[model samples]
Target: MFKDLLKTHLFPTSWCPGCGIGGIMAQLAMAMDEMGLNQSNSVVVGGIGCTGRMAGYFNLDSVYTLHGRTLPVAQGIKMVNPSLKVIIISGDGDLASIGGNHLIHALRRNVDLAVLCNNNEVYGLTGGQAGPTTPQGTPTVSSPDGSPYEPLNLQGLLKTGSRYFYARTTVYHQVHLKRCIKEAIQWPGFAFVDIASQCIENNGRRLGFKTGYEMLAMFRDKYKRAPDGVESLAPLEIGLVKRGEEQP
Candidate 1:
């Protein structure tokens, strides 16, 4: 039933215990339920990454595609059936790194879809390597001495007239996550929600957070909401980067 939304048989998912992915999944399920989405007409498209696995746990119709390819696939599905509600869920590495081109164009074209980007900083599925979103000075498998490059500002990248709607939230704030998801789903054009999820097995350990709860608390401590009402990513205020304004 939509009330539960999850497939109990898939209980004990592959994600590590206390992983924030579960919280994001629950919020997603609840968002759909609140929206009264029809399972047959709602689609969850995922790419090859830890977040991609989200498509399999839900009872709704879902499609799993190659790494960084979720956006194009979801776009095609939306084109074929405009009535269907399409959602692209994947890790930051999958969407903002390798598949960044597709993401930029899709939003620029005003494609009717929702994107849920799980930003765990490092590439959790690929041996804890530093990804495009990994902050500078954070050590990873690829950068044991700490990453030298500054993290990519994905939300800022979308600030140019391309993005129709955008929001930021963390798994620690599940209620806000659901509310953002609900708003994004209801938006008429392209919508993006960047979820600062935690990778307890990798990122947390590397960053010195021994447990998932500590990581969650860290997020709660770090994140703040901008005065404009959209959630912020630390001091960056990612959600309102270009709220109601466009770049030249």
Candidate 2:
């Protein structure tokens, strides 16, 4: 059934062998499949990055927007046809860097949109540059010595709104990742799902990881779900946080 949601003819996506973007795409497709979402009711908007290519693979209508413009475009689409479901897929750099101003306004407006950010931490497509979400001291092509700045506080930023929905999950956590996508799609207002994913050929190798599987193993060991009812999540915890008409 999930295969029906994908343009399987586009098999062997440009994403590198063992790249986590493929995993994110598959899981998202599966989630959409389970949700009864299709070409008639939904659209996927992608940004400029490896993750942006995901939009092309979806069987549903998709928009390939300019760098960092996915949000505003998605917002426009939502505003024009409030009945259609708009979902955005983009990388950390696209969303947190160039598109940051839009991210803030989108959160403040609490528009009915679902954003799935592939937080791989580095700009994988453009020669592995340090991105906004790249952790401090992480080595990259641009930061040969290591990134000197702290990563963006996405959780804190998302939580700034009076009513918000944020969920954190990693690509390695298959079940959780799909669940996060599904729930975010169902959330009434703006929903952001920060998906910690691997950029094996770029970020992973620079971090001394031998393979994508190794990176995945590290995620499996390093992250865990927070207890239910927690107001906020810690750096290593993965869970949902909401403040709206219904309790978190």
Q: What is the TM-score of each candidate against the true structure?
A: 0.92, 0.98
Q: Which pairs clash in the backbone of model 2? A: none
Give the per-residue lDDT digits (tens) of candidate 2, residues 40-120. Answer: 999999999999999999998999999999999999999999989899999999999999999999999998999999999
RMSD to true structure for each model, in Å? 2.9, 1.4
Instruction: Identify the leading candidate in terms of TM-score.
Output: 2
The per-residue C-alpha lDDT of model 1 at residue 49 equals 92
List candidate 2 segments past 4 Å from native.
Answer: none
- lDDT by residue for model 1 over 1-248, one digit each (tens)? 45466786878888989788888888888889878885777989999998999998878789999998998999889999999999888999999899989988987887878899999998998879999999999999899999999998776666666445778888988877888888788777788898888998888887888999999898788777666654334443434322432422
- The 10 consecutive residues of candidate 2 with the worst lDDT sum are 239-248
Give the top-scoring candidate (lDDT).
2
Q: Which stretches of candidate 1 lie over 4 Å from their true place?
A: 1-3, 229-248
TM-score of 1: 0.92
